[model samples]
Target: MCRRFRELAAHPTVLSRAAAAAVALRAGVWSDAAHRFLRRCAAAGNLHACYFLGMVRFYCLGSRASGVALLARAAAGGHAAALYALAVVRFNGSGGGKADKDPHAGVALCARAAWLGHVPALRELGHCLQDGNGARRDAAAGRHLLLHAAARELAAVSSARRRGRAGEDDDGAAASRFMVEWWALTSAEKPATAAGEGGSCGAGEEDAEELRLCSHARCGRRETRRHEFRRCSVCGSANYCSRACQALDWKRAHRGQCGAARWLAAGNAY
Candidate 1:
């Protein structure tokens, strides 16, 4: 199988090269011939090859700078997973370079990855947004993002469990924890009322439960005390009445700034 894969990986077609490289990497076989093939494929502009080669160089060969450069090249070509990997490196100060410790840069990268439909990036961005890490505090928006990510994670866990995949139970447990945390964060908020109705109750009561507007810039629906609106889990900075509205808001603008918010929440500024 290894010999067959090596032969296929050396094929001229880009797809063949990518597939071969992926299989070889996953199989933990890093022969000199495989490495040469990956380098050639990456040089030929195969994004997958670039990513795989980058990972091999960074993790196996201890060439951090070269690996990161390759990853950046892939990310520039719009590879979502590469972007997420870079974000993680930046967030954790890994890779042994000046660029390794830039949380602000990491957050920005994570948000971009999230916009590109990276699931882990979405979850990380949600956490950042809630904590106002690199952006402003917006608890309502943060909570919505977190819940959305958690729901998706739970679904994935369910699928993995059905397949009897190892460690799926742990993933399910984590998803459950996220749900519990979300509930704890939201349980304290009061129900919302209709617009102007709060004013009718008198000026003194207005201070107790302030009226809010929808977080989405395009959908500024006025929230009243009687309305049951969803608030953000981290900072409670915004409110949304429906999942659609929240999703729209996130896609439109929230995703870009969520990382900063999360950084702030974590008591780390950069």
Candidate 2:
């Protein structure tokens, strides 16, 4: 079976099939063998195999160093998802102490992915620029990029609708999906502030909640005055510093949370 898997992975046309078979094996009883198959494919320079095996090793098996090295190899091969994944790892300082957080390097990786037309990286770079998290603050440029990303997302959705399929393999779908997941991971971190800007609002202070960080994960802007930022139209809990941030946030995180159930709950409480 392992010999057959290696043969299939070696063939360019059947590589995806072999990966799928490996995944199925992992799901059933041959989990260890599946991992070994993936590792072999990755070592053989399969980009997708490298990415999948790297993520599993990093997050599931706790082999952060080797996993990151594999991911870096994939990124160097011009794999857009791999680049974006590495950007996230760097930005969050994963697998290292807080001192390892390299937001600047992360921003550079996002730039490369965005250059390849990755929508999430584009949105992320825009947010970073707006918030000056890893780059110089350029609200105008950031807003423009955000608008561009939103337009691309809408186009992707329209195309998917026309095709009568989810279009999960498209550039837009992967990025949007990743952004939502990334937002979930980083939402709890408070927005940074300059000197003398004071601290984040304490919990349970509903009145002062409006001053909290922008709902957009990459965007760290805080409201300067009462009702300075606008709230989400549906959920009314999320706040955005601008329409661009609002649109991006909707795609990233608010879309899932702004369901009818949430609206009803908030309405009844009010």
Candidate 3:
């Protein structure tokens, strides 16, 4: 299949080159010929080829500067994986050279990638938010994102188990174990608030204040005639005054807890 794909990749078309690059990546074909094909495809503006070639150059060939440049190019084109890769590099200062470790920039890049639906990016962003490494501390939002990521991993595991694919179960089990550990850690950090401490008026005031404010983090805009909030369709635990706020909240926090209510109703361990 690799040989056949390479032959087909000889064509000058963008799709052919991209397909060949993808196949080569999957087959771990890091030969000179494969590199040449990837370079050609990347030069022709194939984002997948650019990302694969960048990774190969960075990890396999140790061409850090060149690889990072290629990754940056791909990221500028809105490649989520490339953006996540750059975030990792920025966070760790692993590529050598100046070793300019910028945690804030890394977190921002991760947030962008998460917004683009990258799972690893979501996990990284959640960790950053939880620890307040670069962004403001928001334990609730971080937990929400982490749980969502775990749920997504669980969904993947369930699919793999159903398919009976070799090695997938091991991966799923590892993800599940990580999720369990994370949940335990988060649970341990919960504050011990005394029940029945506040009077009825205080509870009522809190509930009214919560109802009047938007659920999106830091927005806190009180609902008014111009800004009528709507409850989330899946969890209904939060409300948003506008679609933009809703989308931001979903990307940053609610995505993890979204549909969780349904999963619980169906007796799933979400």
Highest TM-score, which number?
2
Q: Please give the RMSD of candidate 3 to the true structure.
A: 19.2
Cα deviation of 240 in candidate 1 (Å)?
Answer: 32
Number of clashes recorded per candidate:
29, 0, 1
lDDT order of candidates, best first?
Answer: 2, 3, 1
RMSD of 1: 20.4
Q: Of the candidates shown, which would achieve the greatest lDDT relative to the real structure? A: 2
For candidate 3, the 10 contiguous residues with the lowest summed lDDT are 198-207
Selected candidate, larger TM-score, 1 vs 3: 3
Q: What is the C-alpha RMSD of each candidate to the true structure, in Å?
A: 20.4, 12.2, 19.2
Please write out the lDDT profile of model 2 over residues 194-244, one tens digit for every residue: 244443222222333334555877553343334555678776778775444
lDDT of 3: 0.60
lDDT at 212, model 3: 45
Q: Higher-TM-score candidate among 1 and 2?
A: 2
Give the runs in model 2 whose Cα sits over 4 Å from its true position. Answer: 1-30, 170-270
Off by over 4 Å in 3: 1-8, 15-17, 24-28, 97-99, 160-270
Clashing pairs in 2: none
- Summarize candidate 1's per-residue lDDT along 119-234 as a digit string, tens digits: 66787777677777666778888888878877876787678878987433331122223223322322333232333222111111223345454575543223323233566554
